[model samples]
Target: MTGQGSEGTFCLVLHSHLPWLAHHGAWPVGEEWLYQAWAHSYLPVVDLLRRFADEGREDVLTLGVTPVLAAQLDDPYCLRGLHDWLGNWQLRAHGAARGLPDLAAREHRASRWALEEFETRWRHGFSPLLRSLVDSRVVELLGGPAAHPFQPLLDERLRAFALRTGLDDTQRRIGTRPEGIWAPECAYAPGMEAGYAAAGVRRFVVDGPSLRGQTWAGRTVGDSDVVCFGRDLEVSYRVWSPKVGYPGDPAYRDFHTYDHPSGLKPSRVTGVHVDPRDKKPYDPDLAAAAVRRHAEDFVDVVVARLRSLRERHGRALVVAAYDTELYGHWWHEGPAWLEAVLRALPEAGVRVTTLRGAVEAGHVAGPVEIPPSSWGAGKDWHTWHGPQVSDIVHGNAEVQRELLELDLSGPVRDPVADQAVREALLSLSSDWAFMVTKDSAADYARYRAKVHADRFAELAALCRTGRGSTGRGHERAAELRRVDGPFGHLDARSL
Candidate 1:
């Protein structure tokens, strides 16, 4: 049964997430990651949605904002830091204009526009802007576990607590509880459906291989009623694949190989092996033409895929899931391509709906037994639990064991216990292991993991001594609170 407006339904799922990075390093790694994504991806995407809303469009797409990300976006420290980062970006653009006029002009324009947008709309916090979209019913927001943990590997009790707390945080901030979630790394274990059900999550996305390549409709997981939607890799890979994605086009701005004089990338990906100094200069008009070309190509592919699926399944649902940061942050031309695609899809007779909208439109199937899986490198859990990351895995397990063993049921509540739990959760983030395995930012990832683990160890020792509420233990706990205070409402007693 297809929705009344189209032959088939297409759901675009953008998972927006990053690990907690506040008060950490700033340049090259930590808060810079947050600011860059905010300026490039979040701002432009929100603008596109608002433009659609002004034209009376609804059910645009599914957006997953993890609680950890939300906490950072809403934090006062991050807000101030973002404001300053945008200013610095503008300064760099101006400095680049002396040597590279063409590239510097474009960068200057972008920086100024981003600064104006941030100051006018996002100056206060992301909540007001995000809440407006939710209130308008233009997008279905998906929530996930706090800290973006790989839930399949977590302890059962901790898993439940994280899910519930994440939902609670989203509700408090977004003014609505999410009905769906973008599970961290799209990872799944056999019994997670029950935990999702308990947390009031009605549906989630999984990798296509997890469903054995038959990803036409959302399937109920095992005996539970929670629906699992498998991504259509065929369509998604057309836009972004390992071998050839639109971002690698010669006309697009080069992501690597920055100019030494100005620290701005002035070259194009003229040739895969060409030296940065020998590459062709970037031209906005050339990239714009490519964006339109690629957008049309993507629309054509989606339409053809939907028609084929419709012929086979009568009424099929095609879900294309992607990392939200890919749009403008990674690809540079991504946001433009996205805007073009969203506008072109409906015009091409494909109904662009959110995951929840697809379900409500009757595009669902019977239950299927989902195996333990993740959307990792090999379409399995190896990226996170592989031999290369075995040390991280073992460290995580030891920390969890100690944190759980701590007794917080006594009369005098040990504040360090709460801090230890916070540190433990932060340490358990899957980014560390993934980064180590990928060798991208491996050192920073390992440093972050070790820092949290050490903090947890210090606090755990204080808790064991029963001196957590006074002396050096109290000072350390207070310091930790200052460092990791996003979940002030978190109570160790509940754990």
Candidate 2:
């Protein structure tokens, strides 16, 4: 398996990320957002991997767990919240089981199975899942920046720190260093290659457009030895295109509709007249059947592509990547679809492999310089820092600069400086801008930006004047420093 040459090699990289959701907010948005995904996606996905391993099947999966999300997943508060959320799942199962047909009863049973799996398999911290997969040689873990910053928007030097910090965090948890990483949002910008090479990451995933002038597949970035795997557009768009994709299928559960009427989802995506409260009950059986069909169809596409590639290159590889949340969170049936796909792949002659496995086998054909691009609309940075998000992004960048410039050459020694920097960086995440532009949580976006900006002001004043300032931003930053303390021996000299 380690030898060179690609013969039926397919890498599936799932990018798992959720903004620093801890203690943010809840109901329609916030921390519960984290728990809901935990109950629905993360837990089940972990269970799937465990089940595969227990069955003695080494189905390699390359997974990227961002540090910010990992911190929440392992936090005490998140743990408790997840337990309560699963209990709610049990409640939903009871509701489905009562006054229901036999088929419905079976669906309810499946729901119970999912809930139980969350409780039993993922009751412990998530690190165990990564550990089991790496130890059993079924997965090659990938890691990236702690808070998942958009690298180009950040100072160049911080990029390395973020990558190294993320890798270190993963090693501490899984007891093995990761050789691969998923750049946040599949985001790439010019000059970020050196950061990857410095972190010992030999391979990372990029979007399809990065290979504009060259053939798609695994290619090198710039002068670095770090291999860059370009996502296969034909395969990826099949499941997640904006226009016509599996998620848009009428039979699938409606992501926009919330079942306020029946307290359960019971309608197809009509693309109109869909109110959250009026949806129907969630029917797992119907969804599961759909998953099986989709899984088979997907495998068919991969098989055909693999054959075509072999004919041209004598052997070929295809890499299909997707956001981890796309499964159980967005598609609802995603986890089942994934499980079915994994189970069906080998039988269909398509081998499931990780990015590391492909590169380890020398599947990379050549080196190429990747242009600056993101997987956002038009394959640009608009989603994170474009025109719509520029105002807040600039606001954030300005504050970050102020905090970084405050004589942080060495650990802030002063608790106030540390807290101010910590708060500022967390607020610097691109997610707030996205939420504002997408109207997902506009008010929350405003609150986060103001809070961070104010906190940064206060910290800067304290560092210079040795006393908390009276201005609104300055005072706020000072109070935050008092409460959160400091950045903990952080040195700003590198910046």
Candidate 3:
């Protein structure tokens, strides 16, 4: 893991995703998850990147913002809800002041500061902030299927449609298509490489097992030139292991702790048995101190590993990847930790690069056929679209197939065809796969599947009725406008 020359280039991949939760669920559960994360993680992280760039730092970050999540973030309902939630957060801080113990005074003060920060920088929205970062070239925006559907579990007939549709959606948001992808959950299966190649995806991240017997560095999938970079699991898993990681730290915010009395989360994760009320509010000053310690430790590990790698492989680039949500959403102090780490990396002599930059810098190894693999347990797709998730998935996939066959392949062109296509793609997102795997809000997963499918079904119905569209297909534009998200105007004509 350590090599002087190889350590010079390190690539980090951040997968940012959340199932469609907007206008869907209650606080501390669904949409609240989105707003809380927006206030804590996404907004802060994007702001951090923007600040980094504003300071003339060309630090390259490979960020994957799944279209499904993006759609929700950019949705009118979510924007409005987020602003309201920010206001409520302020009220909660103010309300807490009356009952605060002297020992808890600092906690109340920190919450007030957190609220103020949210109001000033994030009250408006994060779409503009994210766009600015991408526009500034401070981070490489990666894309995947509109809803990040695990492709392998999907019926073969629907595979191409999902890939191409997602590609178009990515292009819509970022003003260009992404050649690189953060395959939803790093889930992959044999023969899926063809879909990626057809969609113009030149590179994607995978787990070490996907390399089969190959090394953890980058390699090609099948005979296609598309590069597959395997994650350096040893380093990557240290930040967010389900059993133990930074999130488990005593000083970090507890993800599972809920104040039974107030319905608000106040405690930091102390241990598995700690009571919610017994826990303490997050203190940023303490958390920031921890970040400094962790940053130094992480850098030390990277440097030593690089030195060791130099002894073995002469030069070997280490690629560490993790879910982007871990920063602020799960680990309350994640944003601070991230900032400290990035700022210290250069001083430690480690050059951070985007996934694409690594490919271009010749850090990638020679071509090799990758085996079917994912970052899931045992590098399998079980975490998403496995048996637990497949029963519901197969049913929805059938609807997808019928919809694509009827709506996409027709020669009777319609303006709403692209919107129809986008809806179809979002319906098949890999997010449902995750829900089924985790069993978190299975009903919501079913509803999301139904929502997209229902939209597609509507298009299918209109097409079958022979209700001819207006000039240039503008007559049915209202219907099209309704379906114009998760990637507006898919241009399915290419399919």
lDDT of 3 by residue, 228-270 (tens): 8887766666676657666677776677776443344666676
For model 2 the TM-score comes to 0.87
TM-score of 3: 0.87
Show how many residue pairs clash in every candidate, following the order shown: 0, 15, 11
Sorted on TM-score, best first, the list reads 1, 2, 3
lDDT of each: 0.88, 0.71, 0.70
Q: Estimate each model's TM-score.
A: 0.97, 0.87, 0.87
Give me the runs in candidate 3 sitting further than 4 Å from their true place: 1-7, 101-127, 155-157, 212-216, 260-263, 280-286, 407-423, 467-485, 491-495
Better of 1 and 2 by TM-score: 1
**Position 67, candidate 1: lDDT:** 87
Error of 1 at 206 (Å): 0.5
